[model samples]
Target: MRTQFGSPIDYFLELGADTIHMNELLGKPLHMKYVGQQCLNCGKDRKIYRMGHCYNCFYELPQTADWVIRPELSKAHLDIEDRDLAYEKDVQLQPHIVYLALSSDVKVGVTRKTQVPTRWIDQGANSALEIVEAPNRYLAGIAEVALKQFVADKTNWRQMLKNEVAQEDLFEFRAKLSQHIPEEVRPYFLSEKSDKWDLDFPVQKYPAKIKSLNLTKTPEFSEKLAGIKGQYLIFEDDTVFNVRGNEGTVVEIFIS
Candidate 1:
């Protein structure tokens, strides 16, 4: 699943040798048939261990390094290597931001500076604001860890999908949270004008109840496309399928 931030985020489902324009298919019938799983890393027909990777690739690839989830473990600044020194430095040594976003609720998170809006979109954030900017991922992670004690670090996906978010004053929230920053990373806190980005989704209707689709359980399904939000494709019957969650699943799709 590829996403572009627009008035309502634009989504594209990338199939082999083809791309399906999802927004255009809303309100129409779509048929999808799951064929098999293809390891995104090794490109072999194998069971997906995590994020489309086979077990071997999941354990071997530098992309799946432990530091990915625990940014505090980042050692690129110290010239230390986890899996690959070059790759670690290229990613962890770059600028990163600590942010507050409103999804189901306001939550704290961190991401590379360049991934600003993209990260928020993937998390289905209705709005977001940057609170701090760090020279590297380690400092950003430190900020996030400190803020976690005061605010939640995780988004409630169920509430997010229900579009049941409450309004929050991010500007005020940032000011209060800034005081809690660790002394080591306090200098990196951003004081610029915080801009709140309000995002919309291309959905004719939001489901009152969400029924998730599992490709592994049911190999084929067809339904009328109702909408698209985040990485999910909404069906008329309130059933939603997460394209990114089933990344390595090989499927044939027909939209009409």
Candidate 2:
């Protein structure tokens, strides 16, 4: 899904040639039918092992390199190849941000400087602010590892999707955490604090309890879309569907 930052984030889903304006589907009955599957990499009829890639594509593609997940393992700076050196250098060598975000709780994270608010929005963070601007993913990632020892590095997805959050000032949190930044990365820390981003999701009512929908498990399901937050489609009957999670699964959805 793609998002446009707004008063409430506007979400879009691209399928084939169609662009689904997900926010418009709110409060409408949606019928979804699982049709088939296709690997995002080679477009083959194979089960996706990870990140919408088939087992082969997952292992073979430069995009799915281990450094993608554990950026600290990146060797692109040293001109060493993990999968594809050119691809690695292109992405891993780009400017990256080490940030503090509040979703279910305050957490430290790393992302390309370009991902910015998109990364935070995808995690359903209520607020976020950059703490460091590093030259590459490795620097930002190493900073993340150091900061995680003091603050969380993972989001509690259940709590995030349920809209259970407490407001907090990221600016103050960033200051307290600055002293703990690894000495090597300290030079990149931002002394001039930028205002934290506060995002509003278009949720009509939040579910007290949530039951996840697995198209593979159930195959066919129909429910009224209550709202959308992050990548999950909130439904009236408390069934939530994760669009990004079901990346390679082909399905047909209709609304009325």
Q: Evaluated with lDDT, which candidate comes out highest?
A: 2
Q: What's the lDDT for residue 147 in model 1? A: 94
Candidate 1 vs. true structure, TM-score: 0.97
Clashing pairs in 2: none
Q: Give the residue spans of candidate 2 off by over 4 A.
A: none
- Where does candidate 1 stray beyond 4 Å? none
List, residue by residue over 9-79, the lDDT tens digit for candidate 2: 99998888889998898888999999889999899998889899899999999998888888899899999
User: Candidate 1 lDDT, tens digit per residue, 18-88?
Assistant: 98888889899999898999999889999998988999999998889888988888999999889999999
Worst 10 residues of 1 by lDDT: 190-199
State residue 158's C-alpha deviation in candidate 2, in Å: 0.9
TM-scores of all predicted structures: 0.97, 0.97
Q: Rate the local accuracy (lDDT) of all candidates.
A: 0.88, 0.89
